[model samples]
Target: MAAANGRPVAKRRVRLLGGLAVAALIAGLGVFWAVTAPRAVSAERLAAIEAIEADPARGERVFWAGGCASCHAEKEASGDDRKRLSGGLRLTSDFGTFVVPNISPHPDAGIGQWTLDQFSNAMLAGIAPGGSHLYPSFPYASYVRMSDQDIADLFAHIKTLPASDATHPDHELKFPFSWRRLLGGWKFLFFDDAPRTELADGDAQLQRGQYLVEGPGHCGECHTPRNLLGGLKTDQWLAGAPNPEGEGRVPNITPGSPSLKSWSAADIAYYLESGFTPDFDSVGGSMVAVQKNMAELPSADREAIAAYLKTVPAR
Candidate 1:
């Protein structure tokens, strides 16, 4: 009953408001569940890796291909000092600062206690040993494209690194971004294990380059511009992007850009090996770490990467 104007309240109005409230509650619960759920690798994929033995010798290639040393190794480390995996490198981004954790064999400070499946899950699915979501700063999005064997070999090689008992500092994030559960929703949208592009021409060398660049190398994560959600702009491919950590822009490596249009496949290979451009300029900036990793690869692999880069359509 309405007391103020001496009018009776409508029953239909009350029922309509009640129904709307119930609907809103249901919608909120659905969103909550979607963001909190844990997504992991398939059992079939796990069984595939489990079926074969890992080769640590070949695993060394996987390690360099993945560039584990660049992030996991000690900061300011040069020469043999790069071998120490006592993590302290700080990756500063707009959202927060992520401190790379020690991935060495130290039981308390690293992943020494982790099983191969746990490592595989972290690489492909971005899930941690405790079943929580890992930050995208780890670049698992591209790693999702890796084959089961490559993951196995990489894990084997990681085991061979010397142990470090370094302390791992937690990441500093702004409110809401600090929540790990929210990453499930982020993963649901951006995490696909499929290769970004398929080679219509079926060239073997180009295919190998595609595998290396799209999968473990994760070139697009740095070279391609990102959307507001931080997902790479696939249509643009390697057309260049701003450094999330600030400062200089990442160069466009796609074909026909003036900077690289004149360079032959041999020139690109030489740059990867020696860090020198055709103009005789040495590689600098964050690319320094990647060039070092590329130098570790065989001459054939460097040439293969160049061959693939030459064929990409200019933006």
Candidate 2:
């Protein structure tokens, strides 16, 4: 009888322990779901953006400043072909080879069905339609700094572009990196819309330059180094970084860097406009497309960009 009583006690203890273990697992999953959930812009803000009348003309300026064509256009696309946003460019990174998606106006393949509110949420919140998280490779991290009006205008301008049914392959990512839910943790740690560098005595031109660089131009995406998790190292803003695509490093543009220290603001402006450096070397590599887009901008915008670069903190 004593032996039988002890056996029952042991069985009850085992059952209690198993129940606790199951409870703990359920709680863990709940926490993970909460952390990884997509967060879109507040409905009130979305309403305000919807009310703003967008101008395609102003959006053209935002389009060039944002360098949308450089990544979205076909790899061999040139001249008027750049306007065809049938995304096929393959951007290789440490995480994976991200094939740019078709953002053209095609109702089926592109974002033609996306409303202005959806576009605003994607640009500012990194949330995609149907509540999926967009990978930061889209550079929504920097675009989050853009104004509502600019987002509105940009959507309008993009609509005017020719639509293409051209579809690209999905991103090829390694192991755990392929999981989109993990991106919420990454964004939680690194995504910030704050100004990268603060100007001491900011003027109108300096402010304009700052907006173009920090908001639309997204220069830091290339010039600034990133942490192991692919987060931008804000402490070393514009200090230069290893090129993610191929050989050599992206040049540092901060004042403390020896390469840019010698170039006057005027020289920088001229380089953007003419693609010729002070040494008469022409822009090459990925920057060639960037320079071409910069050349199309009004001279003042180029000057503003140059002026802003002169003020960023040295690495």
Candidate 3:
């Protein structure tokens, strides 16, 4: 059947037409999946849930160290008090805006029902529980280095958090970037299975920094730029990159990168504790939120992070 433009019309024409269109769309979707899903899973994918069920207490520590709650959960509860890992923090970027998802333990809306392997894949592989590639905004690149035992414990603690049944806002990304299936190609370009295998010798401070930046802190997720394929631009490591907040830059932290070099290790540590960078300028943007998390950590760990920063080769 056709509209008033004068095509033939029958009593059941609308129903048949709609059904055929849906069938075609479904066929197209099937084809799309056939092309996309295989690359999302790696042969090295983690094995089971039993691994993550150990040491809930230690997992809680890893959660804090990893700063999971800062990004996954809302900074403040909403009127409905439904902001625990239900997602929906809009992160604007040059390519697109992303809404962070709730990772709380809500059975229906959160990670409560995710199997251990599913959690492992998301953290280690940046693929969601269903084998779909997650946007790098989740920072699994840094997370991939995390020890399996630690990851498992982290998941255990996550299960104990208060659940929120809140629904999240859908991401309204722009063209090309909006095609989630294309993420497989993006993952191939940026994601890797090889974890950090070595650290700088003779520098305990540097090693600590390396662990914090690459693992729990995940600073590179925002501080590093992406190549054409959306992988972190390692050549420009920590040299400054655009952030979703206020279009402010994640300033270059490398020694001579025009941002952090002038500050002493003490300056860095104090700024972390009080949100005051050198020159008395207040830290802002993502760093503000980051400091909130850092302030909660022990003084020694924070200082260790500072020591590590000092060891970064001057740019």
- Candidate 3 per-residue lDDT over residues 91-124, each given as its tens digit: 8766678888778898888888998878877887
Better of 1 and 2 by TM-score: 1
C-alpha lDDT (0 to 100) for residue 31 of candidate 1: 82
Tens digits of lDDT, candidate 1, 125-194: 9999989999999999999988888999888888888899999679998878899888887887778877
RMSD per model, one decimal: 2.3, 2.4, 9.2
How many residue pairs clash in each candidate at the backbone level? Answer: 0, 0, 4
lDDT of 2 at 206: 92
Off by over 4 Å in 2: 1-24
Better by lDDT, candidate 3 or 1: 1
Considering every candidate listed, which one attains the maximal TM-score? Answer: 1
RMSD of 2: 2.4
Pairs that clash in candidate 1? none
Q: Please, what is the TM-score per model?
A: 0.93, 0.93, 0.78
The lDDT for every candidate, in the order shown, is: 0.85, 0.90, 0.71
Clashes of 2: 0
